[model samples]
Target: MPASTEQAVRVAVLADSDTRWKWGALTARRLVAAEPTGFVLRGRATPTARQLAETGVSTTPPREVTGAEFLREVRDAALRGEGYDVVVLALVGGTVRAVLQGLSELALERRPVIVTGYVGVVYEKLADGLLLRHGADVVLANSRHDAERFRAVYEGVGADASAVVEAALPFLGGAPYTPEAGRDTLVFAAQPSVPATRAERVYLLRRLIGHARQHPGREVLLKLRSKPGEHTTHLEELPYQRLVRDLAAPPNFRLVYGHMGEVLDRTDLLVTVSSTAALEALHRRVPTAVLTDLGVREVLGNHHFVGSGLLTSFERLDAGVRPEPDAEWLDRQGVAAGGDAYASAFDAARERVADLLAGPALPPVSPYYTADTAPGYLPGILARHRLDVDAPEARPGGLRRLVREAARGAYRHGVQRVAPAIRRLGEL
Candidate 1:
C-alpha cells in the first residue's frame, strides 16, 4: 500500500510503566492512523518507554519522558495549541486527571484528546473513569457493557453511553479461529497478579501439574505474565523455583514466553484463573477452562466466569468433562475482535474522530474546574518521569542495536548454561 500524504493526525500516547495500558494506547493509535504517513507517534514515560523495542511487535521506542514532565508538556503544549491531532491518555486512570487539570483553567475548546480504556476485566467506577467521558473527545471501550457503563456514570444519565466508542481491542491477535490439527498442548496462563499470596500461587501451580499428569500425552505449557524474576507493581508473591522443587514436575510441562499470537497458533486448550489472556484465547475459539477449585475470589477473581459455562474443577477434569462456552457470556465478554465486527467497530471510531475534527466549533469543557468533580493529584504522571517540553531524542537503531543484540545473545547463552548450577549452589 502507498503511504498517505494527507493531513496526518499526529497521535501521541501518554505512556507509563504499564505494558497492558501502553498496548491499549497503541491500539488506538494504529486504528486512527489507517493511513501510513497519517500518523506521527510518540510514547512518553520510563519503565515501558521502549516497550516495543527489539520485539516482533514494533521496533520504535516510545519517546521517553518523566511522568511529571509528561503532564506539564502535554498541558503547556495543549495550551499553546496545534501540536497533535489527538493525545491518547489512560482510560482507567493516569494522565487523564492531570491533563484535565491543566485544561481546566485554559479556555481551549478544540483540543483533541482520546482516552483508551479496556473492558475485559471488571473494575468499579471509583473515580468516575477519571472524568474521561466528560473531558476527552471520546472514550474508547473494548466491550459494549463497558461502553454503557462509561456512558452511564460520566453523563449521569442511563439514556446511552456518553461519547463512548465500542472498538475491538487492538492488541488481541485479531487472527481467525482455526482448530489445531490435534489437541496436544494445553496452556495455563498464570497471572498471580497482586492479589494472590505465595501459598495461593503454589496451589495454582500444583493444580496445573496435576492436570498435566492426568493427560500424559499433552504438553502443558505454563505461560507466565512476566519472566521468572522481574520487577513489577503487580507482584506474584512467590517465585516459581521455590514452588517447583516441591512438586513432581512432569517432563512435558515447562515455562514458555513469546508473542501470544504465535503461542495461540499451536495451543489446543487454555486454562486460567480469570485473565484477559483467557478471554483472548476464547476469542480465538480455543477450548478454555476457568479453574475454580480454590474458591478464592481475591486471588483468581474467576467468580464472574462461573456462570459462563466454562468453569471447571479437578474433579470435572478427571471425569473427562469439557465445558463449552456459552454464547450469552461470550457476547457480553466482547469476544473476537476479528471478522466483520472488528471492521465495523474500527470504522465507527474512525468516523467519529473524523466528524469531531471536521465538524462545527465546540465549546470549552470548563473555565473553572471543580474539586468535587476532580479525582485526585496525578502521582506517576508528574513527579517520576523527567519530562521536558522538547520531543524525546531519536534512538539509534541500525548498527548500535545490532551490536547490542549480539552481545545480549552471548550473555543469554552463558546464563542458560550456568543458572541451574548457580541455583543448586544457592539451595545449599
Candidate 2:
C-alpha cells in the first residue's frame, strides 16, 4: 500500500559538516513538504555552535552522532516501525558507502529513500566519489551538466544510472541583485584550505589588502568560513585570519563571517579562487569573478570555471572589471540566472522522491563495493567508520565505549591541533 497523503512526510538529514548540513536540510525542504530533522556526524569537522547558528537552519539544534551511534539509531527506529520516509546522507563518498552497508545489514522490512550528492562543484575524485554513492535511491545532480556526467560515469562503470536525478543547489536563493545607493561592497568569499600553503595564503591576503588600499571608496569584505579554532568542511592549515594580522589593513577592509546569502545582499562584486559561493552569487545575478591570480590550475579548482566567463584576475578586478557570466555557461552549470528556470530546479527531484514514498518498501542499499567486488577495498572504508557488517557483536560497551570516545577525541585533537603545528614547523 502507498503511504497516505494525509500523514506528514517524515524526513531526516545526516551530514558531517556545516556546509553539508545546510545543503542537506535545505534539500530536504525542497524535496518533501515537511520540516526535516537534522543530524550532524561527530567528527573532525563537526560544526561548532557558531557555525551551526550561522547556517540559519532552524532553532531546533541537531543531534550529533558517531557512525556506530547513528547506525544503532537507524536500527532502533526500524525496530520501532518508525523509519524515516526520506534520508539525505550529506557526507563524503566513503562515509555514505559505509552507512549503506551498515543499513543493509539491519534487514528491515522497509528502508528510507536514500539520497546523496556533492555539495558543490564536482572537481575531484569523480569516479571514486560516484561509485561510492552509487546505490542511493536518488544521487542528486545539482545541474543539467552534472546529471549528464553522473549518468555517463555510472553507465561507463556498468552500474545503474537510474538514480542520478537532476536538482539544484538547495541553498541558492536571495533577493535578485540590486545596487545599494553609494555603497558598493566587494565581498571576497574565502575557503578554508583551497590554497593550503602559508605563502599562497599570505599572498592572497596581501592582494586583498592592496585592493582595499587601491579603492578606498569600496568596502572590501573578506568573507570567512570559520573562526580561528573552528573547523569547516575543509581543514585550514594556513588561515587568512592568522596571515592578515602581519599586514596593515585599511579601515575600509574587514573580515566578516555570516550566512553567505546575507553577505551577498550587500555585495556588488563577489570574488573567489574556487569557492562554491561563486555559483550562489551567479544564481542571484550578482557580478562574480573567479580569481586566476594563483593561475588557473586544477589543484586550485579555479580550472572548473574554464568557460564560465567569470574567470579573471585580481589585476582585472583592481582595474574595475566586473565580468558578466555567459548565459550558455550559466545554463549548463544550472545557475539559471533567469529566475524561472531556478524556480523549477527542484521539480524533478521532488517528483522522484514522491514516487518512491508512494511506492512499495525500498530494498537494501546496494553500494558499488562489496566483498565479492572489492574485497580488500570495501573493508577499509567500512572500518574507518567503525562499521563491521560481519561482526556486529564486536562493538564496545560501557567502559570500553567510554575509552573509544576518549580515543576518538584524541585523534580529532591531533588532526585539528598537532598536525597543523607540525606543518607550521616544516615551513620554518
C-alpha lDDT (0 to 100) for residue 345 of candidate 2: 90
What are the per-model numbers of colliding residue pairs? 10, 0
Clashing pairs in 2: none
> Model 2, which residues run further than 4 Å from truth?
388-397, 406-428
Question: How well is each residue in 342-384 modelled by candidate 1, as lDDT tens digits?
Answer: 5465676777777766665544543112454332533444333
Candidate 2 per-residue C-alpha lDDT over 237-294 given as tens digits, one digit per residue, 9 for 90 to 100: 7778778877999999999999999999999999999999999999888899999888
TM-score of each: 0.75, 0.93
Mark the 10 consecutive residues where model 1 has the least summed lDDT: 36-45
Residue 257 accuracy (lDDT) in model 1 = 66
